[model samples]
Target: MKKRALLIIAGLFLLTSFPVTGGSAKVTQPPSQKEEIIYHIFQRSFFDSDGDGHGDLIGIRQKLDYLQQLGVTAILLTPLYESVYYHNYFATDFYKIDPRYGTMQDYLRLIKELHRRGMKFYMDMETQYVASDHIWFRDSYKNPQSRYSDYIIYTDKENTKPLQIVAGISDFKGYDGVTRKLVMVNLDNKEVQAYNYQLFKFWMDPNHDGKFDDGVDGFRLDHMMDNLDNLNRLPHLFTTFWNPLLGKLRNINPKIKIVAEQANWASFGMDYLKDTKIDRVFAFRLAFAIRNFNKAELIKVVDSTLIQTPKGKQQIVFIENHDMPRFSDAVKADPGKLKVGCALNLLIGGIPSIYYGQELGMQGSRQNFGITDANDIPDRQAFEWYKSDTGRGMAYWYKNGPWWQHNNNDVPNDGISLEEEQNNPQSLWNFYRTMIRLRKNNPVLIGGAYKNLINNNDHVFSFLRYEWGKKVLVAVNLSGDKQDVVIAMQSAKQIKNLYGIQPVISENNLAVSLPAYGVAVWAVK
Candidate 1:
């Protein structure tokens, strides 16, 4: 069955941007902030000034030029709170920045520099649990008579939970949610809900004003709807936690964006995420779309997702992210297919999220963070800084030891490095550059309604984006053999070439012959 969906753009101005007129002459104003890109800074491999081998905020500041060169306008840094382990999922404290990553002064400098460039900054917050080393935990553990003991939920009758592990690392030594050995407040507990609320309040209260600081505009919600035994299913948990958080944040900053980490399609949270209050949703479905699909098959997935997503919220699009296998690893490390996948991500709806090293074609299947053998951190190799030299000076900033090793052979020094792509116009870097520029040039592509063009085609996939009476068609050929596709358009003003396989002026029907792994973009006049 075909689903019809409509996306109404809000708080967005017309593309026919007018110049400011002061008295009589036209005056130039600052460019649109909406056009800026948001780069998710993993911070693990960003830069290391201290030579301690982990990326820190200072290192991130040093690499701002690289991000700016890529035309990125914002950086979504992972949690910087003090934690005992890597990834920092388990927070030891919410009030201060981790010393290993750098002092608060470094973070302030990063914000200052980014703001100077007219860019935005967002920090990740994990409201799940505190590490065993946290002051709250210490206080609760050391003093049984202290009032802080109420922060942790313990059981005198029975033990329902076991030892806790942060991000799959069992040695984290955290308060288990299921077992009561070290009591961690159960998310499902109604009595502890207030405590969780206070935790969030404490995390956002920078001035200790007991109020959230409005300077932070957005958040990268980590493991948002996971590990909820008593909280029930995804939809229920979202209503239980997300709605409240959204309400609280909106009461302060109405423009804040909430990006949740829940990826389940069948879950009700998927439907709830489309709420108008939630501005954007992370496109988790793309990770499952690997070498298993042809161009035609990929289109169906995109169509289904577009239909399911709420019209008001944007879908965060991407080909590869930190948690998933690298795009290069999907096509059996085929660089050509990687370009096609990335192109599709850029052309699709929502904000495009580029993972670290994806631009340079880093390769890995999965990773073992030295815990379980089957599940591991794959493709998370250190960045190769030199174009020809062996990795010598590349350093990471976090003092905590990394769970995984650099597994891939591709580095900055190799021929397949980012440096090579930047110089070569035909390289994948230019392809991304062109794609981003195309998205910006065509307002219809950004704020338009997405409609599937070809439903049952075997080798070709196509769709049309419509807005402001403008329509743009995007198609991709993922099959190994060449195939012709019949395009559907309402008018005779169809023009293809800016992002498509060939130039065509279709009067109702357009025929396109697509090569394997080829992507095309067309516009309607």
Candidate 2:
């Protein structure tokens, strides 16, 4: 299996894309603020700065030009607060910046640079859980008379042992091999609520100047939920916990957009939108259906999602993220299928979030390497910065760890690094660039309503993204064999080729012949 992958890697990958129109097309008005193409970065795995082997705020600041060139309007970073864990989930302190990732000054500078380029920055925050070393845990634990008592959930009347959220959960073993106890915070506590508001407000305007230039544009609520751990300890939190806190945050910064990672990935997230103040949620169903490559499943999920989502709210679409296996792994490294995934990511009608390193076909899977956090290290490896796998900007933070032996996918000369793909016009990275530019250039693709286009072929997925007086047809062949699909349409002869691939007009209907794993787009009146 490894030999076959190496052989495929040697050839590199080829994808066809042409400039909109024959060349130098007419300019159109840009899309609204609602159409932000978010580039989600696993901050630890992104580019390194200061030769620290760890990705830092200054490092991200240095790559602003590269991110802007890729056409992403905003960046969504993983939690940056102080945490012993490598992923920064079990934060020890919500107010302090992770020293390894850089200082608070570096964070402000990164946000400043992002806003200067007309880009937005979204900070990831999860406050429901904390490390055992946190002040609230340390000061309150086993101390019922302590002022910070009731800040953490304790089963005993004496307030000794904090309620364990994860089953059989003990001290969390960090990727660095250090163990720290994890605690579930008491969300129902009023003081905790007040502290949460203060923390959120502090990030909104860190300088306290009220100029808002240095603050993050919004936040990604990590593992947001109404019920705490389904233990029935904290229920109806949307009204009591979230809405009140979020409403207060909005009062401080009305424009602060919050996207929730709903606790249940299988849910449609209408409840989160309807019951809470969240602006958006990840469309996991659509993502799963897209990966499955089944026409019926895609249509079913998309249709249901579109119909159910309320006005003024949005669904974030992507093939994979920090928690799941890379899309390349899902398709077993098929270059064509990878391109298909990219096309759908931008061509659909939703806020598309391109995960960092996904553009270069980065590969990893969720490993069952025991209960320790190391199991997630496989999917969260360093971003491939060089084809040779060694460079100044390489964020290979896991190199010296025990998993170093298991950084099995980080092969030299595999042609999966940004260095190899950035310059190659036919590389997957360039394909991502082309698709992003395509979506940004076309107004209909941004904030457009989605409609499934009926096609005879099961291997092909067709949809129309339409707006007032502007309509675009996108057809993708998700299979390994060429496919011919007929779509019902009238006056289709005037179809304009907005992309390299297009179909012929048979009578009054549209006839599209897509090569194996090919994607095409056209403007149909």
Candidate 3:
């Protein structure tokens, strides 16, 4: 591990010639809720090191310059713990780093490097279930004499039949044949709770140092819900597990942020936020509405979500994530629509998170279930770092996997690679970088209150972000044709053009002619 770290640092020195947009300086203060712009990365698909065709922690450390260049203040990484699956959500061991992602030393170096660059790191935690190979499951399943016999929920005394829960109406039970059946943890047991608490604490202070600079800044709790297994088995989960656990974590680090991924995205996670005291939750309703181009629905959902959320709490605004198709693919890879989506995602009230490869407009849809072994591989394809499929840094580690056979490896030459788009002024990558810089420089856009502006045109969605006598107006045209719309705002002035069609403000009513899928943002005082 020490040798690997030395090699990674040497590689980073050779790449230091690349220009970084954001200055290199260690941040004295921790990132605030208002100033966070998170970029999510799937480690396996990001960049490879050791020529192993698998992305690792060292790879992420090497790309800190790229992320800093994009103007993101924080990074949300997928799970890095040991798991049999490629995604690593179902952890076999919570304390160990997956060998494919590199050693524990590599992870520590990555965290230290991120902090050195004034960036925050958040990790995804899926502690609800464990892989069949997990010690808790192995010992408890069909082994009454084992001390961990009560650690997992089982249907029979002999423990041959593990209790399965209804994931959804369509799926009666949840399990992957590769891992047999994932055993859901018995959170009711005191010993089980202790294990999870220790696991969380270890990641937060891996070296037992007083300072947490080498630890994660926050966590994204996956598939979090009030009811366990959707069967009301653990109805008091918030009271029993979450509140206490969060209280302990807060005692350790009060600034730690915990965001929940609601089991059902259709409904607001108000219960979890209020009861569990989670810091944030994903705005899935808005994401779905935006992807479908439901202009009215999008506006309505955004309004309700922002209005209903309690003060001091936050929503994680994103277009796509590891579990879903990329936003570009969702909109059929139309660059115009992708730009509009990015505009809304960044300009909204919540902290925006950009999924990896989103800025380059990478396109790949998840294959339909039952048709492929690993349906999600297409969506998690290697980042298009270069024009060629087998270029350096390409993580085609799953080339022998079934999903790779159906993967979208034929990305077009134009508008795909960072090397290509970084040079093109109007490319999607530039659009994201420019918009992010704008948001970072503007205080109103980052921490302001949201107000839905009245627009006569149904296809045009407009809003205002105002705070402390400062205001910014954002208008997005979701349609494929030009539209003239009047925005209702007082004392509005066009200060700058963030992206898309430039707006023209006249009096209290702002009138702008927007091209197809156009976006305009203005600083109004």
Candidate 4:
């Protein structure tokens, strides 16, 4: 079937580069640079070069080639600091990488390796609460006026309310057994306000001179929204905490990128934080829907989100993360749907994040506390890298990490491994690789203006991406039946390539017989 093509771009070329000249010749060339793409790594799946089960910083360093192969420019690692739990959200010490994951030297080696490959890294650090076992917490509990005294906000015993820890792996008693003194950060208390300011300084200031150092490149702020009740209050917190941190980090390295998880807020919040030195904020709502086969819903969410994000601030796109349901498990374990989602995320504006295991279609869910495992590791488990039936290395990188405990041990779930998928051209891993290529080749789709095409058919989603006189129309058949879409835009004239189906026009209406859950893309003539 002939698909209707929109007048996307006047010049449709794959990749543009200047021709080389003889060694003796001096020729001026345009600056060569590409936009950046950051990939998220779960601590468990990065590498197992030593035949260990756990993924350490050295493991990540070993797989830089794999990450570079996907054209990812940066890496955002979940917390690697000292902690009893797996995810390391409740940090025991921000400065120390848990011995299980590797050592500080390992992290330094990782940073050096990534930097050598022209890639950057961001560490997830929780600035709010420490683990119950944290020395600061222990010291504060023992003596109210101890060294860690100002770290926590102390409230009067009579007025303190019982607080329960629900999110992380372990629960700690809060204010229940306290009789004389109760402490909560009095953000309201101006005298103790420095406590909040000092928390950020702990990351930046090595000498405690209120100056940020060059030790780390960037920080991925966890639970950034917890301190403030509303969006308006973010700016003050940013100026006091984030802006200085960014400035300090930049002082050490100018190209550093700072990002945070607002958790709950409009995309416009990125704009508010931009002045505060935040480079990006993860687009949560948009990416969550893409984890499922909801094209129409994803389109709407992306459109609304981009509208709210401030200019120059990125809409960090992602499908799954440590906090959400594993992407593979959400789409009924369908690889096709996963590919389509990957295409959309890579092609959309702003930076794209590939949550760990998204490449292998890892499946997971939350039963009691919602998607969290028994170890309190957010449902994201250790990477399974066993050899496939073909004898390819499924996970040579995870030789040191422990295998994720499966809900059903009887099932033959170990058959699907990365090395196996790497050899299979039609596997989910290859599909993701292809989508990343499309995004890298087509710059217009990355930052282009999105015009969503709405029609009577709910299963078909069509949209136009126009930028710099270039146009590309993208349409996806989200359902099983063939859809006869009447082209509302008369300018759609010729056809390019359908993602997985042949486009044939019928009855003068660009009738394309799209396969079940198929996608079509037309490059404007």
Each candidate: what lDDT?
0.60, 0.82, 0.78, 0.58
Tens-place lDDT digits, model 4, residues 1-525: 112232222223122111211221121212223657778888664565454556677777877888887678888888877865556666677677788677666766777677677787777877555655676666766466666655654433332231223242234322122112212232333433454445444444335554333244577877675344342322256556555545755665465567878856444455445556777788887876666556556656776666556655666788787777676667777656776677777765667888776777766664343333332342455554544222222232212223233331112436466656778888877878877776656665666656665433556677666565555667776665676554344334566663555455433234455666667776654
Each candidate structure's TM-score, on Cα atoms with residue i matched to residue i, is 0.80, 0.92, 0.90, 0.77
lDDT of 2: 0.82
Query: Per-residue lDDT of 247-309 in model 3, one digit per residue for the tens?
Result: 898899888999999988887777776878789999988888889786667767887777677
lDDT of 2 by residue, 1-525 (tens): 122321222113221122222221122333453458999998887988988889888889988888888889999999999988889898888998999889988898888888888899999999999998888888988789888888888889787778888565856777777788888988899989999988999999998888889998899998888887788888778989999999988988899999999989899899998989999999999899889997777877887776578877888999979999889999998999899999988888778999998888999887765668887777888888788988887888878767777674579989898888889999999999889878877877987777665555667777777665577889898799988777656555489898857677765567778899988899886
lDDT of 2 at 493: 48
What are the per-residue Cα lDDT tens digits for candidate 1 across 3-52?
22111122121221111122211112122325646777667665676777
Ordered by lDDT, highest first, the candidates read 2, 3, 1, 4
Best by TM-score: 2
Candidates arranged by TM-score, highest first: 2, 3, 1, 4
> What lDDT is obtained when candidate 1 is compared to the true structure?
0.60
* RMSD of every prediction: 8.2, 7.7, 11.8, 8.7
- lDDT value for candidate 4? 0.58
Error of 3 at 163 (Å): 0.9
lDDT (C-alpha) at residue 111 in model 3 = 92
For candidate 3, the clash count comes to 0
Model 4 ranges off by over 4 Å? 1-33, 49-52, 157-217, 226-240, 247-254, 265-276, 291-296, 369-378, 388-415, 490-495, 501-511
Residue 292 shift from truth in candidate 1, angstroms: 3.0
